[model samples]
Target chain A: MNNLVEIVNLTKKYGSNVAVNNLTVSLPKGKIIGLLGPNGSGKTTLIKMLNGLLTPTEGTIMIDGNYVGPATKSKVAYLPDRTYLTMNQTIREILDYFQDFYADFSRERAEEMLKSLGIDPSVKMRTLSKGTKEKVQLILVMSRDASLYILDEPIAGVDPAARDYILRTIINNYNPEATVLISTHLIEDVEQVLDEVIFMRYGQLVLYTSVDNIREEKGKSVDAYFREVFAC
Target chain B: MLGKLMKYEWKNTWKAGMLMLLGIFIVTVAGCIVLQMPGGVVSNLVDGNEANAAQTWLVISSFTATLILYVIMLLASTWGMLIFLGIRFYRSMYTDEGYLSHTLPVTANQLFLSKVLVSGVWYLFIMIGIGISIVALLVSLMMGLMDISELSGVLTQYNGNVWEFLGDGIYELNRVYEEQMGMNLLHYGITLLLTYVAGPFITMITLFGALTIGQLSSKHKGLIGILAYAGLTILSSIIGSTVQSVFMFSTNIVSSAGGTGITTNWAYDINVLTSALVAAIMYGVSYYIMNRKLNLD
Candidate 1:
């Protein structure tokens, strides 16, 4: 259970172009881990495999000691990079849906977050601004008392101020015993809050170490080092 | 979980269906009523004056236009319902909305069954709506041609024993048709009804299976899905025709080269069996794609 996510030799290919190569890694519990990578580096692909969105071409992903099935899905809260909700449905309906399916979903927590943002639960998703919709999606994801939170580009769509609020929500609201796996290209903004970083390059793991170690041992911030290594 | 999925599935799909059904009811009633107007006008033609003739022509022209519109509305809405359901499945299970649906704590079978069952139920409701509309149309047409008293007497003769009345009605119908042919009309009707009810389920499976196949493509997935569906339908029709021809040639069911061809019920039964088997296979294929071969971008 300490290793919340165990991906073993996972590979996802589209016709012969490998998206996620034979990548294997173990993520520990109770830490905010930044899955940092450049564009097309397979960060979202790997996150998708863990959330059961894409079936891996090979290998396995075990979350909370369960294979990526319904049992594992109940423990993983996934926020995809796009708006996955229907435009016609009200936020209240989606909340009911989540509460019905995921035992870990908390309606009160989600409602509280919505109230804080001055968003009416009765408002249809179509009526919300893109940034507000992303915030709502983040709210729904963070409201779940899940064992693993897999968020893909969670802050990419929001404004700078809302990004800070969303980052705070992610850092403060998640289960202390759970792990949060965030995939994003904006490493500098997230490096401060990350307990650890898993830097990926070309669908291969480049580094997996603590943020303190990156700053202390490498004598550079994660942002400064990332810019140096991934500079085009 | 399947029930919960179906609840939302029903909610998401029912609004357009309700509106379509209401439109069908309104159009059928109004069309039938207006169709009675031309007959009423003719019956009241006293001396065929110039104004009366012009009015009659106007009425006839309007009636013809209304008839065309009614037919078009019925046919378009029926086809529209199927297309809407297919789009629903594609959007919720294949497009951006799939991110929410796939990540839920539910199995692939649950998702597939929810869409199939909901779409099937909608088809059944629509068939019933169409059936009721047809009955209304026939009743109005009959009323226009016959006296109200005569129609009331006919209704009274049945004494509200609907089962007996239906039985007698079918018996009379077959007794008349049996003079020239020797096929069971009830059996043929039952087969048709089965196809009417079950056809949409097969179509639903084909659509979902095709969309699932569309996932294999890098782009133009929805269009590719439509092409796949067209391919499946063409393939099914070929299979249906082949099976039908085989039954015809093997059994030698025709009376003569042109007299009373296909009088037996074997062809309809085989058609149902073929559709059922194809749907089962496609259902299995769609489930497999959703389960293992899913490649959402």
Candidate 2:
């Protein structure tokens, strides 16, 4: 399989404190990878670096064969942890903005998804509940036919039903050839969908292996292993 | 892309812009009415005489208009800056909303360019609005619809050549308008577009500088951002003042060498261009910072 994302000796620092410490990881195409970590474990930092949101203190990251810059950014879809939509904009307006900027944006899928959720595209984003806003954001992100979808805590702030809907949206709308890197602490919920897992701790990657490998080798679920690895 | 970006920026700030424009309109109308009021009515009500009523009204109206104009200008610019820098940057980075912004498959340069374009458009609109209000007042006065002699007197006191100044000002205005009009309505529209772009360009720099400092600081992210902004402002101001002082001193030297006074046409034009160049440089610095070191994470 072709490597979709390659990070070489990546290091990100906030003053004297290192956020991502000399990390080297490469994600293969067509896989759902869980970037698991506790708070302040550098998952967000690493994810940010991959998306070209943050400049690495050292080393390089390549998206496909291209260096992570303007060219690569065009191919990557990012869903940040917090709601990024302006409060005043309706769902339809946001979608229109997306269509304006991204040629790959699937307006049909977005409208259909919103329709299924009983979300009127004309309703302002600020009027929605937190979970609904997340859904709106998810719909927007997933509607794009991007090469890679980097979702930072996609299900972090929602109820159970919303989480399921968000997961289903990801599954339903995801392009088969693309990669999905979802960062979340809800290990069990995402474990079934995630083909591989990368566990991070204290700004370092503690373990990176296939979910199948963990299940087959340890005869234990990813949740059990996560508890063991990140147990305080 | 820039067009779209500007459209949205304008949309977002439309409420504030509209409010400012409305306020200007109301003030202009009120001024006209006040200026048109019979001298005797105002004088009898206030001081019991119609004498010097036009002058009184003009002074009051001009002062009021100037104040209103300044406030509206400041508010419009502030709104533009806030939307261009504060809301847009926050949403583009550091928030879940950035998913839409960063994932749009557009280059950062496109994003930045769009913001600058929107800001430029709005700023131009603001200047035009002010100009229109002034012209409305002038037209009303010219039609003998209002007592504008008082206002004219106040203007003369400031420069002692109201008619000449008005003529020169109108000529300059026409020249700018004609230059823009030559490009069709599209080009004329883009004049404001380019001007508005400068606001966001400056804003991006301030934001980048603030974020850089925020990342470096151990605590007080907001406070640190403020300090960073202040530092940048101070640095720019000091540089500007120093350059102005140098130019003034040098111009004085030249004037002395030519055995003339410090006032000269060449010196004035040079000063204006120098300031414009400085503003351009400041904007360039801002663009560079945002382009090179935007820390969305």
Return the top candidate by lDDT: 1
lDDT of each: 0.85, 0.71
Q: Candidate 2 - CAPRI tier?
A: medium
What TM-score do all the candidates reach, one by one? Answer: 0.91, 0.78
> lDDT (0-100) at residue B157 of candidate 1?
86
Residue-wise C-alpha lDDT for candidate 2, range A50-107, written one tens digit per residue: 7766778898888989987667877888898877778888888888888887777899
Candidate 1's residue-wise lDDT over B94-150, tens digit each? 889998899888999998999999988887788788888888877766555555676
Tally clashing residue pairs in candidate 1: 0
Superposed Cα deviation of residue A69, candidate 2 (Å): 2.4
